[model samples]
Target: MATGANGQVGHELLRALTDISRDPDPHPYPSPGGRGVQCISPLPPGEGGAKRRVRGRPCEIIPAARNGTLENGTACERIDLADLDGLPRALDRIAPDLIVNAAAYTAVDRAEDETALALRINGDAVDVLGAWAKQHDARVVHYSTDYVFDGSATQPYREHDATHPVSAYGRSKLAGEIALRDSGARHLIFRTAWVYAARGHNFLRTMLRLGAERDELRVVDDQTGAPTPARLIAEVTALAIAQWTDDAAPLRDGVYHLVAAGQTSWCGFARAIFEHAQRAGLIERAPAVQAIRTSDYPTKAVRPAYSVLDTTKLRDAFGVALPDWQVGLDGVIAELANTRFMNREK
Candidate 1:
């Protein structure tokens, strides 16, 4: 059961898992073999198809969202995590082997005023998921943010570092992490940073929109983190799920950072997006992006100045190493351009 099916990560996760589940031996790459220069091993024949099943049956996608299934019609489980009254009964009925929860209140600034709702969805709901998974001896895959830290570290944050969230959104997410840890459930908490997708409303798309409308845009240059693609995150997660069932893969359920190999500032990211857009013919020329500090773009929620995550542990444990941020950006930029071009043609 995958929550937030219509969301950026959830949507890609659905696609990746479905692709892997259908394939005989799906590797960690975007396509059949792999993309770019990344050295991802081809999936073991013993690991993929059979292991994705529960009781010798194919796993069903239960898109647990308030608005129900997407237009594609795969997931029919219309569940709202906020109002989880029927969660236990529903879990009892489904008895899912693994629950990948990609849902959360991601309104970073609005979470300050809507603390209750954020806590209800991000913190309390996760606690419930964890508890239920524990009861069923099932595994839970939960997504977390790097905002759990106050962005005070000069170096990348370690998994064992102390958490001090500055924003309400961060607090709620941190609470979810603590709840999952205490729930005693077999869970994998992935802490990622600067996530974006071609289809979703994110920084990459936002910059493209601004570039189309204006001649110049000011981006925060001080903030730094890897712009991780939702596709890579989902694919790696699908690989993790497949590997978890195989004893030889060594799946130790714990918190790990899953991010791109390299880092960049928001300014650098915007410049790259425009450059890619120009190359893809989405834009004729790159926009003039002005570099500014965090103080220039103040919001209700305080963002981290620097929140680079260390993914060495994840690579060492799961043998999953993500490609550089630029590589993922190129894929998304091309897709975005093609979609726009098609829409214009129509």
Candidate 2:
């Protein structure tokens, strides 16, 4: 069962799951319930959220938030995090062996004022899911953020690094990781940074729109990190799940860093976006992207000066490695230019 099916990673997760099921991917471990994907959440209100499916299997994507009535006639949508008991009811209806969770309160700055709400969704919710997984003997794949660190490290962060989150959002994410660890369930926690996708409310899309309307923009250069694509996260997760399923014992449950290779600043990212945009003819000319310090553009919440994550553990364990950030960015830009992604909200 896939949670938060509408978010950036969730959306691609569903796609990756579908790809796995359709392909004759050899799984060393036998699928307990056979091969299939069932999404617990739906799309936006109007697109018949429960209608999407996988090609060669009994796939389903159910649309329901914690407040909304679940497929089993139980209201398990919006408060699913706060409502612990509702998970069992929803799980009973879905009977999924693997649960991929992508839901979280991701508003960085706003989390300061709504710390409780953020914890409920990002932290406490996982506590409940971990408890459930322990009882049911199921598996879970969860995503985390780079904010877990305070950005004090000059090198890429490892899974064993001491965590000190400076913002409420980061703290809440850390809480989720701890909860998962304490639960003792078969799980994988992926810490990713500077995540942006071509199809979501991310930095890349924002830059495209602004670059088209304006001739100059100032982006932060002091803060540095790898820009990860949501697509890469999903694909790697699918591969990990396959490995985990096949090698039940040797495949130990732990944390891994799944992100694009290389590093860049927000200013560098913007310039690359504009370059791709001009090449795609989305913009007639590339705009002037000026580099500025993070202090020049203050935000309500604190961001890490550097949030690069080391993927050596993940690569050695799963034999999966992500490509460079620019490679993924170029593909996303080309996709955005060719498709009607700009008009998605309309």
Give the best candidate by TM-score. 1
Candidate 1 lDDT over residue span 1-346, tens digit each = 8888888999888877776566636434445234422323333454322233212234665666657777577546766778867767777887887899999999999999999999989999899999999888877899999999999999999898898999999999999998998998888899998999988789988998889889999999999899998887887787777666554332578899988878999999999999888888888877799999989888999998888999877766665556788988887887787788899899
Candidate 2, residues 181-293, lDDT tens digits: the string is: 89988899999988888777899988877877888899999988999888778877876775576555735589998878899999998998888777776667887999999
**Please, what's the RMSD in Å of model 1?**
4.0
RMSD of each: 4.0, 9.1
**Can you give the lDDT of residue 71 in candidate 2?**
38
- TM-score of each candidate structure, all chains considered together: 0.90, 0.84
Q: Quote model 1's TM-score.
A: 0.90
Q: Which residue pairs clash in candidate 1? A: none
Pick the lDDT winner: 1
